[model samples]
Each structure stands twice: as C-alpha cells, then as structure tokens.
Target: MQSDQLIVFAVLAATLGLFVWNRWRYDIVALGALLVVTLAGIVPPEQAFMGLGHPAVITVAAVLVLSRGLLNSGVVDSLARHLTKVGDKPWVQVLTLTAIVALCSGFMNNVGALALFMPVAVWMSRQSGRSPSYLLMPLAFGSLLGGTLTLIGTPPNIIIAGYRREVGEAPFRMFEFLPVGLAITAAGVLLITVLWRLIPRRENQGSDQELFEISAYLTELKVPAQSKYTRRTLHELIAAGGDEAEVMVIALVREGHYQAMPSIYEVLRDEDVLLVEADSDSLKRFLDVTHLELAAEADSKAEAREKAEQEKQAEKNGDTLAQPDANESKTDRHKERALAEAIVTPGSSLIGTTATGLSLRERYGMNVLAVARQGQRLRQRLGKIRFAAGDILLLQAREDQLPSTLSNLGCLPLASRGLRITAPRQVLLASSIFAVALALIAVGVMPAAIALVGAALAMILVGLVPTGDIYKSIDMSIIVLIAAMLPIGEALETTGGSRLIADALLEIGQSAPPAATVAILMAGVMLLSNVVNNAAAAVLAAPVAISLSRGMEASADPLLMAVAIGASCAFLTPIGHQSNTLVMAPGGYRFGDYWRLGLPLSALVVLVAVPVILWVWPL
Candidate 1:
C-alpha cells in the first residue's frame, strides 16, 4: 500500500475502534479522526471544515427542525390519541404502533418519530400488563424500515444521492427509493409483528411509573363563568370525561365547606371548586374540553395582605394590576411556556421547603402544579405542601426557564412527559408548510436541502415552532459526528484507500454474479452500520461501492442503492441507531437483547432489498 493510503487506513481503523469502544462521545472521536487526517496531509487545510457546510449536513439539520415543529404542533399527539383507542390486544397494538411510526418516519427524521411515540408505547405496555420489550424493538425496527421509502426519509439516502452527482449522474429522484424501501419496510414490519415473542420480557422498566406509582395528581378546578356546564348535573359532567375512566372526581367544595360526598345528582355551580384525581394527560384533556379553570391556590395571610397593600398603592398611583388571563395568546407569550416534571435531588435546597416559603410563583414566574411523594396521596394544596428530596413535581414555566430552573433548584428532570393542547389551526398550518416543501421536492422545483430549509424557516416565521427552540431541536451530536466523519471519508478516497478496499472486495466476489456482488456489498455496509453511526458508515462506504462497480464495468446505481439500504438497516445493535438507543431504558433492554429479533430482521432486509434493488435499478 502507498504511504498516504497507510496513514488514512490507520486513522480510519482507530476511528472505528473508538466508535465501537464508545469510551468518549462519538462526536469527539470523529473530530479527533478529522484532525489526525488533516495533520497527515491527506485533506487540504482550507477544506477541513467544509463538511459542516455540506448539503447533506444542512438537510439533516433542517429535517430535524421541521420534525420538532410537527411535534410542537401536536400532529403526533393527534395520531397517538387515536392509537390509544385500540384495546389491549397485543397484535392490534403492535400493528397500529409500527404502522404509525413507519408513516411518520417516511416524512420526518426517524429518530424524532420514535421519540414522539416511545412514551405512548410505554403507556400502552403498562395498560396492557405486558412487557415493553415486545413493542419497543418492533417500533425501532419499523422506523428504520420506513426511512428507506423516501429521499428525505434518512440521511443515508441523501448522502448516496449526493455521491451519485459526484459521479456525473443526475441525483436520484425523491421517490426513486420508495420501491425497494417500501418492500423491505412492509416485509420487515410483518415479520417482527408476528415474531415479537422472540424479544425478551424484561421487568421493572415499562413506564416512568416509579415516580408516579404512589398516587394520581389531586388538584382543584373551578367552573368558569363561561363554562357551558355551569348548571349541569354532576353525573352529566362526569359522563363528559369520554371513554377514559381513569380520572375520578374526588370531592366538591362549595361556600368554603367540603360537601359531604356530593352525589352525582348534585348540580355543579360556577365558582365552586371541584377536586379531581387524575394523571396529567387526562387532567389536561378534561379541563380543556370542559372549559374549567385551575383554581388559584390561597397564599398565607401575611402574603395576601402584602399583595393587597401593593394593589392599593398601585391604585393610588393610577396603575391597574393586570389580572392573569386564561385565554392569553401564546404568540404574545413568545417565550413559549410549557408544563414539565422534575424530581428534587437528594441534596436539593428545595427539600423541606414549601412552595409558599420559596414564593415560587412570585419570584420565578413558575407554578407548582402537583407533587408526587412515595407512599402518600397528596390531597392538600400544592403551594402549602412541603417538598421532600425524592418528591416529583409537575411544574409550569416558560420553555427557556426550564434548564436554569432545574439547575438552580437542584432538581433532576424526569422522563415523565406532561401534555399540551395545540390548537387545530396551528397543526393545519405546520402540516401545510411541510406538505408544500415535499411537493416542491417531488416536482423538482427546488433541491431537497433548499426546500427543507425554506420549510423550516416558514415554520419559525409562522410561529408553529418557536424561534428560540430551532437550534435546540437540531441534534448537534449527530451533526458533529457527520461533519467530522465526512473529512475522514474524503481523506480515504484521496489516498486511494477506498480503491484498495474495493479491489479486495472484488477479488472475493470475482467468482460470484454481479447481483451477488451487490448483496455482499450491502451486507458489509450493514455490519459496519451496526457498530458505527449509520451516516458515518454511508460516507465511508459510498466511494468503495463506486470503485467496486467501476471494477465490474457495471452500473453504479445498484451499488449505491445497496449502500443506502445497508446503512439504514442498523438493526443488529442498540448503538446502531438513535431510535434503538431511545428505547433501551424504557424497554429494560440489555446489549445482547437486540440480536434476538434484529438478526433475523436484518437478514430479511438483505434477502428482500437486494432483488428489489436489482429489479428496480437494473444493474
């Protein structure tokens, strides 16, 4: 081998070793590899950082932001609400979940789609009294399968298309991937659904039930003056809770006295406090659908007096105190407030302190919505409750205040998500913008990267996704991993390292048919993807595939398509895809657990994708 090729090979070997070792962050390892290659005089100094500006990198970032906008607009939530209606039948549940995730993956980033549905899967497992392991792996695999169906479905497809342009060919059209991708996805989804029994049944991991198992949240809501059910019978009101019977109406308070187990026949009156026991999603849905307002917690006498004095002084100074509005415009509240849960750490100063003592609402512009403590049913007022070290608190605050508030309060954030009700109009607007971007790409009106960037910007301009969260939505780790690895890939090609590898591969496949050669290349990429990030694997494998195709004097389309299929089918290990990693904790999955189902599923992908690619692209 040439001296330059030897250096590039050494650097790449070390980089892959580090990726599998996983001692440091993948991004850090990739950056180290990039620096080593540049110092080795392979990649030019001026072009070292050019990968950061690559069209593939920009497209990935834009897709992530658009996915977040769809999430924020409640598109996923709307779909999940429908999924919950399917009963406890495991087959029905798995089919519905996999299909939903697959459909979402086709249009958005697959990782984002998996995240949106993970909580739902956990909740479903808990409700069905089944192991979450059965559902999560299938969900992860379904996402991988679905991403193959569209050009923007996954990063590997975009990278392969870009590489085609470098080889003096027109880029693959948006739907060109759909044929093989759809075949593999459909076959894989069906196989997993029937064989999910192969997945291990793990214990103690389905949901964030540890923090919430104590009891449901108990809180009070007052019947607003504009409520349609002001004079409705309690029986009628409870019936309005819909099919969900989890939430219970605990007690009713009228005229400052607790009504003695008020019967369902009793009428609900305006300004009367009704104490309800329910989980966060149920409670939010009940309140919004019923038009009930959260009752303000009573402050201590001294605090109330101080507030009255401040109001009097303001009146004398010709100033009016603004009453907080329940119907406040979220656009006006541009900071985008949110409801989230946090647990007080063991050494937190918040321990043993009451919300009233901390003056949390006045000082931090935050509200303690509910608190959950072990072995306790907290029916008391939220503000008067003294927090414990292990207590989980449901808090309402601006999105920007969350990290700082959690850090300052010495609390750890929990994975237990809270619910938000997005207006239908917002969902329509965001979905429309996303659709137009896809249409632009399909008709060749614009390139995929430019079209998606425009869509993301429109989402921000229309306030579908908050401007401050645009950067937060983009996964910087994945971006860094891709950007840093691209230079290393370039160095390999520049040093003729890819040709060497390709020659070796061709020698091994020389006795085999061209179609078999394509399958072998696909399997190699899939194995590499199982250990490293899929995008990095694609960048490294693309040139090798091109070289192999050149050696055979055959079309490069099938070889490139094989790389796209292989890189996306990272099913053999949890570390292969973010979708797989996201489910590890919630599903209580071990490292060895993935191969049980993934091994067969991955083989099936190769068995199916190879013939489909050859038939469709015609090598």
Candidate 2:
C-alpha cells in the first residue's frame, strides 16, 4: 500500500482501537477519524459527516419511531399475559418465551421484542423462584439471534441490502436471508438454552422474591370504617396508628362513604377506616382500623386462599414447578399507563437509589416495579436497594410522565419493546403503510431511502406515528456513527487501505486452499464487526471479499457469504451491535461480560457458518 493509504489505514486502526478501548464516546471516535483523514488530505473537507444524511440513517430513525408507536398501543404487554401461561418449567419457559421473543423480533424490531418480554421474564423468574440472571442473559441473546433472521430484524441487514442495491443490483427480498439466517438462529437459540448453563453462576443467585417485590404500598391514611375511628382528622390519624402500625395517609374517604382520594386536611369520619399495607408482624397488634372490616376482608379471601394453598400442597405434593402460571386466572390488570424499557446511563444518579428515595412515586407519579440488574431479580425492598448503571429498569407511569422522568433519570428507553398495539384501528393502516414502503423499496420502485421518507411523511400526515416524537425515535448516535464512518470507509478504499488489508489476507492464505481464504475473510469481517459497527464491517468487508474471490478466480458467493456472516455475528462485543449494548444497562453487564458468552457464540457462528457457506455456495 502507498504511504497515503497507509496513513488512512493507520487513522482507521487508531480510531477503532480507541473505540474498543471505549476511552471516549463511539460517535466521537468516528468523527475524530474523519477529521484526521480530512486534515491529512486523504479526503476533501466536503465529505465529512456525509453519512449522516445517508438513507440508512434516516430509515433507522423512522423505523425506531414506528416501533415506538407500536409500543404506545399496549400490544406487547398484552402478549406477555398470554405467553406466561404456557408452562412454568424452566426449559419449557425458556423454549416458549424464546420462540415468542424471536418471532416478535423477526417481524418487529428485536430490541423492542426483548423490552416487551423483559417484564414478563422477570415475572416468570419470580414465580419460578429462580435467579433472573439465569434467564435475562438468554433472553438478550435470544432476541439478538432472532433479529438476525429477518431483513427488518436488524439494521446491518438493511444496510447490506441497501449496499447490494448501490452495487447495481436489486435489494434483498424480504426473506432472502432465511436460508442462512434461520439456520444461524436455530443454532443460536439452542446454544443459549443448553450452553448458557455453562456460564458461571454469580453471587447471590436464585431468588423468586424479586419479581413480587413491587413498590411498597406504605401510604398515609385517616382511619375510618363503618365508624372504625370517628372524629379523627388526617393529622391525628397518622400520629395514632403510625407507631404500632406504619400507615401514612395517602388519601381520604369522605361523606356517604365515598372513596374519593382525600387531601391532607380532611378529618376522619365515623365508620370510616384507613386502608394500609404493612408488615404482618407490625400489624399483629394494631389499633388502627376496626378489626371487623380489616379482618372480614382478609378472612373471607385469605382463608379461602390459605385453604387453596393447603389443597395445592396436598395435590402437587411439593412439586412447585408444575404449579399453575402466575396469571392463569388473570383479571384485567393492565391499565392505561406508559410502560418503558430504560437503561440506567453509566453515570446516572438514579443508580443505587430506590423508588422511594428517588420519589418515583411521589415526584414522577410513576412506579419502579422492577429493576433488572445484570442477572439479579430485584423485586423486594426496591426503595432500599441501590441501583447501578446498566440496569434495565421496568417503570410504570402515567403516559405523560414518561418523557420528563426518562430525561431526569438519564435513561435510554429501548426503541422496540414498548410497541403498543393500542391503535388497533390503525393496525392495518400502519402495517400496510410500512409494508408498502418496504415492498416498494424491495421491488425497486423507489430507492429504499425515498420509500421510507415518503412513508414517514405519510405516517405523520395520517397520525399513525405522532409528529412530535418522530425525531426522538431514531438513535442519533448510530446515525452519527454511520454518517461519520461511511466517509472513513470511503477514505479507506480511496487510500487503498482496504485493498492492502485484503491483499495481506490473500497473501496470508496463499499456501492454504481457496476454502481457507473464505474462512480468513469471515474471520476478518467478524473482527471488523467486533471493533467497529456491524454494518460498517459489512460495508468494509464486502469489497474485500469480492476482491479476494476475484484474485483466486473462484465464485464470489462463498466469500460474500463469509462477509455477511461475519458482519452480523456481532457476538464478541457490545459495540459490535446496538442490541447488545441495549441490554447492557438492563442486564447490569460490564463491558467485559459480553465476550464471556459472546466469544464462544461468535466462534460458533464462524465454524458453523463457514462449513455451511462453503457447502451452500461452493468456492
């Protein structure tokens, strides 16, 4: 390679090395690379940030918005209710949920699929009395595997399809990847189910209590009953009963026994009793509400529930695994609330703060029902446990609070999971519009970019996706990275860096057979995917694959397939794929944790993919 090319190569290498080192934000790394190239005169100044406007960037943003709209409709949560009922057996639960999540990801966004299922998975972990750590990692990995199977499942696939078009060919058909992708998916899901067990168990594993430990129900209350405590004001109520039984008056019941929420000033009335949820020991000797009202409600249902438990113990004979699904006799529990999947940002103040201290309930009017920290189940004493960065917090709040609360918490909501199918009225319309756009692009009626832009405009005009949130849905970091890096890739090519890299591989494989060249291409692309972004890796490696194939005078399919397989196998590191990073905070995963599971998965992909690629598309 010439000196100028070497300079570009050196710049690209340093940029990627720093990015993997993660000393600075990845977007900054990409920008720095482009600036270095421009200052070095490898590329003109006009080309900097050009990739920001690329079609891939725009489409990714639009898709994210559309996914958010889907979440806002409450479709994903409803799916959880039905799914949790399949079976409570560990493998059975994993199989069913994994399949469900994968199917969800295949059609929708994979990240969304994982987000939607996260709560449900946590619930399952609680009901099963297992550590969530065992389940969540598999869930994350499964979602990643599923998304790779479909064109819309992941962005890299979309970018590859777009690149295929730019190379003077039609974009990939909707299911073009099924042949290789499905096989990879099958292998991946199986690996997770079986091999995931091989991962070392962490400290304090296996707690069923985490899921059931929803927000503490402690609230202030004026004692009332059918005259439980007459003539007591709200101020007097807390003082009288709070010592023996901890109760704060959150609200009041008023005249004619109306259960309207009360203000602080109201006096307790005759026959009115305060409602409270407290620890049983503290409530054992309480002087609050009339014993009759409190006792009656508990004995009727409580006795019956206790009797049912006894009967269940006798019938099952200590076999808890076969017990009914937690929601087998479910009621209408879901309400008009905003549910979101937010990752605790690395430097967030919310880490280590519980729901009470953060005033999530009092301030934001939301509840932090569950905190997914790495593989731990944190369902109990939530107010007391310190949160950490990288935990995926499952929050519930009024629809309006989501925006501000998220901003305050320094959390990034997963774009894909909260898809509410609430707008069933627009289901056909929204889906049809998306499908039409996809079809138009796939069939070459318009550039994928034009079709997506048109669809986004149409979606806005029709009120499918709201006009306000359209921009927020797109991941600007990714768009910026792609935009900044595309020119860098171009510079790499222009400066002959890519060619030198390609020649070195070809020369390295000179003594080996042509099949080995394909493996080298696959390995090289996989490394590229691991260090840079996956789509960027695919774009960088494709021409290299083609060039090496031409040099060896062989069919390019095997080599190209190698590049494709390697690019999408973003297993070894979080930076390789957004979905991987998306789960990091929620899973409480350290930057180094992914490679522990992913390194093997990536190797599996290369090994399985190489033989398959060679067999299916002979060299």
Candidate 3:
C-alpha cells in the first residue's frame, strides 16, 4: 500500500478505537480524524470540510425537521394513543408495533421513526406486562425495513442512491427500492415477531406498577377563620408534625393571588391558603385532629370526608356546621389539590411540548406548580418559559387524577425519571416526515435531497422541535465519521486496498458460481458496516464491487445489491445506528446485548437479501 493510503488506514483505526472507547463525543472524534487527514495530506484540505455540506448531511438535517413538524401537528400523538389499545396482545402487539414503526419510517428518517414510536413501545411494554427490549429492537429493525421502501428513508439508502450519479446513472427512481424493500420488510417483520421472542428479557426495568410510582405529594392548606393554628410559624408546624409532616411554605395564596416559594419565617394568617409538601400520612393526621378538612384531597375523597366532618361538627356547633352545601364543598375540593410537584425527567413529555399550548389544564385538568431547575430554581413565570428536556416541574392535579395524568402526558413520575424528558413525539414526527419526503423522492416527484430538506423545514413550521434542537439532532459525529472515512475509503481505492481485498475474494471463489460471489460481497460490506457508518461501508465497498466486476467482465448489479443489503444489516452492535443508541438508555442494555439478536438478524438478512437481490437485480 502507498504510504498515504497507510496513513489513511491509521486514521480510520484510531477513529474507530476512539468511537468504541467513547472517550469523547462521536462528532468531535470524527472532526479530529478529519483534521488529522487534512494535516497528513490524505484528503485535500478544501474537501476536508466538504462532508459537512455534503448533500447527505443537508438532507438528514432537513428530514429531521420535517419529522418534527409531523409530530407537532399531533398526527403522531393521535396514532400513539390508538396503539395502546392494540399494543399488548402478544404476537398481535408485535404486528401492530412493527407495522406502525415501519410505516412511519417509510415517510420519515428511521431514527425519527424509532424515536416517535419508542414511547408507545414503552407504554405498550408497561401495559402488556413485557420488557421494552422485546418491542424496541423490533421497532428499530422495523424502522430499517421501512426506510428501504424509499430513497430518503435512511441516510445509507440516500447515500447509495446519491452515489449512483458517479456511474453516470440517474439516481434510483422513487419506489424502485419498494418491491425489494417491501419483500425484505415483510420477511423482516415476520422474523422479528417470531424470532424476537428469543431475546432474553432484561432486569431492573420498571414494570407497570412501578412506572408511575410517586415519591412526593404537594397539597394546599387552607387557613380558616377561627382556626387556632393560623398564628403558628412554619417551624412550629414542622416540629409538631415531627417526621409525620415536613413543611415548606411554597407559596401563600391570598385573594386568589400566588407567591413564588415563600420564606421559612413567613407568618400564617386567616383566609390564607398555603402550599406545603408533606407525606400523605402526616397531612391526613393533622387535618383530622385539627378539624381543618382537606378540601383538595377530596376532589376524590373530599365528599365523604367533608360530610363526615360536618356531621361531627354539627353535633358540636349545632347550627354553624349544618351540611356544608354540596356544590360549595365540591368546588372547594376541586380547588383543594391545586399544587403538585414532579421532577422533570430527561425523556419527559414536557421537554418539547409546552404546558399552555398543550391545554394541559383543560385536557388533563392539571396546573403548573413551581418548576425546580436543579441547582437553580426558576424565577420566570412558570407558564411562560418553555419546558426543557432536563428541567424539573412541580405540578398540581386533583389527587385522584395524578397517576392517569402523568401517564397520559408521557411524563415519567418524579421519583423515577427525575429531570429527564420521556417524550418521544419529536423523534416520531421527525421520522414520519422524513419517510414522506422519501416517498416523494421514490415517486420521482422531486430530487431526494430536495424532498428531505423540505420535510425538515416542515418541522420548523409546526414547532415539534426547537430551532436550536434541529441542529442538535444531526449526530455531527456520524457526519464527521462519514466525511473522515470518505477519505479513508478514497485511499482504499488509491492504494488498491479495496482491490486487494476484492482480489482475494475473487481468487477464493472465482470459479464458485455467481451466488458465492454475492455472499462474499455481502459478508465484506456487513463486516465493514459493523465498524463504520453503513453509508461509508456502502461507499467503500461499491468501488470494490465495480472493480471485481471489471475483473470478471460480468454483470455488477448483484454486487451492488450485496453492498446495499450489507450496509443496512448492521444488527450486531449498537454502534451501527442512532436507533440502537436511543434504545440503549431505555432498554437498560449492555453493549453486548445487541449481538444476541442482531447477529442472527444479520445472518438472516444476508441469507434472504442475497437471493432476492440476485433474482431481482440479475447477474
């Protein structure tokens, strides 16, 4: 090999090593490698930054935005809610989930599809009493299958289609990939539903009963006229309640006015309602002994408690305590449980969606309490500041509705998913729009790049993802990786590295039949994909396939298909795709677990994709 080619190889080796080690963010590592390549003169410095603006990179960013718009429009939200009723019927659940993810991916980016559907899968897993692992891998795999139906579905397909221009071939026609993609998707869906059951369940994942476990309760205390405790200090009440009640006067509500969290020595007064955080057990004891009825707690238990208390007080006061008017008490009870607190989780529903915009109070009958901003408490008006991925929110709901409200909004309960966003809607929407753009491209209505970029702009129109977040979703690391590796791939051709490898394969199986040649190419691309981005794998292997064809003086279509199939079949590791990285957190997975199912899935793809490619593409 030429020394320049050797240097390129060293760059790839170091990049992969660092990627595996995860010493730094993947994007930074990729850029670092690119810089090294530039300095080493492996890639022309001008072209070194070319990958950042490559059509593939631009298309991915735009597609991501479009996916966001589809979700923000509530198309994905409505679909997810419907998925729940059908999500838990075992094999039926698999079919439903697979079809949804696959169909969604066909129109959006694959990662976007998986992200959109991940919550539903998690929700399904909890509802069906199954591990999310079962559904997530299939959802991810289904997304890949779905992407193949169109040119813009996944970056690999786009990259491959785009590269066709190098051969003086028009890019793949829209729906050209559909027949093969559909066949593969159908077979893949069948395998995942049947064979995915073979994957062992993970431990430490929270089940349904544990999903919404509430660790804290925030309620309001109404200071009534003639109440003997009205003059007490915050410390006095806390001391009296002991461990039974821990009190912080979050706010004092007077004449319907609210204050941000109050101070420790804040004096109490008649007609003032105070928001306090205390255990349910202690709060109940205090209410019973002191004769202050919890008007709010009863929005559920309120009716029974208020009546019982009035009857008891009537016997003592005779006149002042006659049954408190039922309507009056109902209103009071509804108003009672007015404050609740939950820590926002990284994956929370509130991350991208806003409270005022979502009609949270009207739709879910809940109100925003004070927001807890980790080391910093929020001073901005709670309703004005947009909810972020990691900010904690204190909310108020009728005590009885807390569980359902939390679950419905896709917010993980504070005790469990503190300060993390659990909402997957943005991801889902991003995927859907991406898929649609692909459909448009596949049908030849527009160029694949234009279709994808349009979808991303659509995302901006709807607000599913923030302006800043649009850039955040691109996975610059993968972009860099692709760019940096593009030079390495160039070197492979320059030094005959790919030719050298292709020559060995042709030598071993030169006489073996066409099918064997297909297999060798398939294996080569799959191996390369495991260690690099699938697009890079396809790009590197494509020239070799063409070279091998030149050597054989035969048809190269089968070889091309081999590279395409191998590029998408990166099932053996989480590093293969962002879809896999996404599930890593929720699945509670170790890096090793992907191969348990991925290895066989990959083998199956080769076994299946090869024959189909040969039959369809011809020798």
Per-residue lDDT of model 2, residues 1-619, tens digit only = 3878778778867876887786676777877888888898877888776777777777666666667655544555566768768767777777667777876676566666776787677667667776555566677677767766756666676666655543455666566666677787788777777666654444343463432243354322323345534554554554555455543322233432333224434666654534444455545445434332453353356558876887888777855434445442111122223456567754356866766677665566565656676645654444566876567666665555575567566675643233243556566567777778878866667765677678777777787667666765565666777787777767776666666677888889989987777777777778878777776676667666656666777766667667777777777666666566655544445667777778777777776777777777687
Evaluate all candidate structures by whole-model CA lDDT and list the values in order: 0.79, 0.63, 0.65
Per-residue CA lDDT of model 1 for 18-117, tens digit only, reads 9999777788899988888888778888988999998889999999899989988988878876777888988888888998899899989897787667
Which residue segments of model 2 deviate by more than 4 Å?
73-79, 165-171, 200-205, 211-342, 345-389, 392-423, 554-557, 582-600, 611-619
**Models sorted by lDDT, best on top:** 1, 3, 2
Q: Write the number of the candidate with greater lDDT, choosing between 1 and 2.
A: 1
Task: Give each model's clash number.
Answer: 0, 45, 41
State model 2's lDDT.
Answer: 0.63
Which regions of candidate 3 are displaced past 4 Å? 216-440, 443-446, 454-480
Error of 3 at 154 (Å): 0.7
lDDT per residue, candidate 3, 1-619, as tens digits? 4787677667767877876675565567767877887898767777777766767667666665666566555566567667768735678888789888887787676766676677677667876677776777777778877887765566666666655655567766666666667777787888888887666576444353332123364577776677776787644554565444434344556665665444445666776676655556656766665555453652436567867887888888776643445466334433444444344433345766667678575577566655544224455544466875335456766566775576455444332221223257655666676567667775678886787677777767657656765755555545666666565556566666667777888898867987888888888788777766676677668778867766777666667667777787777776676666556545656678888877777777777777788787787
**For model 2, where is the 10-residue window of minimal lDDT?**
328-337
RMSD of each candidate? 14.4, 10.5, 9.2
